[model samples]
Target: MQQVYPQEPRPFVKWAGGKRQLLHELERNYPKKFDTYFEPFLGGGAVMFNLLAKHPDMKCHVSDLNSDLILTYVAIRDKVTEVIESLENHSKKYQKNTNFYYYHVRESEPTSQIEKVSKLIFLNKTCFNGLYRVNSKGKFNVPLGRYTNPNIVNKENLLTASRILQSSNLEFFCRDFETVLHDIKKGDFVYFDPPYQPVSNTANFTSYTSRNFTDDDLERLVNLAEKLDSIGCKVLLSNSKSKKVENSFSSSKWKIKEIQVNRAINSDSKKRTGHSEILVKNY
Candidate 1:
């Protein structure tokens, strides 16, 4: 018998707060009707991919604050063959000397778009917890993971995502989240998956870019959501269950639903369990 594969494209990279596990709940909460779909904090793009798969004709605008990540998405969408070739080379060399090769790529910065994206993907696959973290100097600095075998290439998923990105009416941007306020229309649907408000002092891991997502940034996000709401746009936001987050979306206009999720990036396996996140929706 021939093998079967999923029709939908999955997220290419492992993001810090990826929502692959929360798709069902997110789908349930999607607004029954909307125009364009906008996702500003496009981390792993699990939600975007899911939405596009279900409604391929939807006009989608996805972006992120991380330029390197945006470049990765562009490269995969335009030059997937080149990306797969480069990943194959990295995989072969990594299998030979995992420790040295991993550090060499992590330490050496490549300038070309293809090399930059390929290096980012390779490091993300081999790094500790598949985390995309940066140092104060804006450098990729995550350590190596102890995996016996890492799926560096992931050719099928890349091809599927590339097809989705190319065939769909999608636009990419590398800008601040608030910029969406200028482009979004009244009936559009916007999903905000900003770096979750840290649940605890030590649980803070918002280093996807050099600048951390501070309390002020969270306040800005809430303000932006409110603005979107005032414009009559359908908005859905996913955030950690914290007092700050709870207080921000406490208005009667927003419906807050807490959903349990598994934190795959946590260093401590024990702490990954029993984590609850809130989905605040205005429809």
Candidate 2:
């Protein structure tokens, strides 16, 4: 029998707070039609890819605060062939001696775009819990994850993502969430998947980049969401179902819905239990 493949493009990397699990809930709340789609906190790009596949004709723009993460997306979109070749090289050496080679690759930082993206993907797959976290000095610092086989070179998926990005209507940016403020217009559908607010004193995990998403940042996002709502734009946001997140949105215009999301890929199996997340939206 011939093998079957999915035409839907999914996230290539595993981000800490990716929304692949909650996409169904999100889609249910998504605006029926909008002029454009904007995702400010494009981490693993799970939601972005899903939206692109569902709305190929929708004009979309996605961006992230992490330079390296954005570089990986750009490299995949522009130079996928070169990136795949580099990943193949890394995968071959990694398979030889996983422990020894993992540390070697983690320590070296490549300057070229393709190499840098490949390195990021390699470290992500091999890193502890597939987390894309960085240190205070802005370095990839996650330890190696224990995996018999970590699909480092997912060539077909990468090719599919590249083709999706090749769409003339889709655009990507490497900047802070505030960058989209000036360009967003009325009738646009904006989805904010900012880092989750820590649910408890000991559950903080918002370190995707050097600059953490502080409570003040969440406040800023709330203000922006309100502004977007005032301007006739539709806004949907997801964050931890904590007091901080709940207290941030006070407008009657926005409705909040709590939903449980899978733990997905956490190092601590104990902490991998399903948790609550809120979907706040302005329709």
Candidate 3:
């Protein structure tokens, strides 16, 4: 297949805890080839896009509990021209009182699918540290980001992702992680990029979506991973190097590996680099 854009596909949205930094190490650990690729915690789809850009014909399935995020993916796949137009309008309106525009869009509850996705991508790029946090009522609360020029409409990258998403079997789901149970088969590769178990109390930022992915969710995830392992599916998971994370995957069969990653999106700029995260696998 011919590449539609000059640059290869990547995550268009600047998602927190997105795996852009860890791709090289992940590539080293990836299967030489696999039947299907499954990513349950598809944040910005850093890993998914990286793999998809290289392996366009690979059957890839992704999901997130964040419905709005999934909607943006769907919009990009089916209504990209409409989304691009809406985003361009957002770019035009943002020039005047950018701060006011940021909050105004944050508080919006758009009924149209294109409008909702445009607002989501716009806020993701322009919000503080590219953070996507919401309160109990699911209202976005992150402040305006410190950027002189946020790419409100990255037409090339958006179009590239949209084209890549137009693959024959590019599936998206807005369901809980364990729902992928029955579809997975032997020789498939499943990469789990769930919200990391906070290494420190001050570093916890699980509100990527409206709900917090607590330790309980991690437990459920571990059970699912084990199920996938028992059924002969190869599984890999990423998480903070915490005692809980260590204990959860301490079984004799699982292989735990640690790698360093920069904490590029922390609130406190001083502590925003150099941290260890664990990659647990059942290959």
RMSD after CA superposition, every candidate = 2.9, 3.2, 1.6
Candidate 1, residues 87-206, lDDT tens digits: the string is 999999999999999999999878889999999999999999999999888988889999999999999999999988885489999999999987898999999999988878898888
Q: Residues 25-114, candidate 3: write the lDDT tens digits.
A: 999888786899999899899999888888777898899999999999999989999999999999988987898998889888899999
Highest-TM-score candidate:
1
lDDT winner, 2 or 3: 3
Worst 10 residues of 3 by lDDT: 1-10
Model 1 pairs whose backbones collide: none
The positional error of residue 277 in candidate 2, measured at the CA in angstroms, is 0.7
Off by over 4 Å in 2: 1-6
Instruction: Residues 1-283, candidate 2: write the lDDT tens digits.
Output: 3222358788999988888877778779988989989998898888888877866666898899888888888888889999999999999999999999999999997788888889989998888888888889998888888899989999999999998877788888888898788899999999998888988887788888888889889888888888888889999998889987787786588799999877766667877877888999888
Off by over 4 Å in 3: 1-6
Model 1 earns a TM-score of: 0.97
Instruction: Provide the TM-score for each candidate, comma-separated.
Output: 0.97, 0.96, 0.96
Runs off by more than 4 Å, candidate 1: 1-6
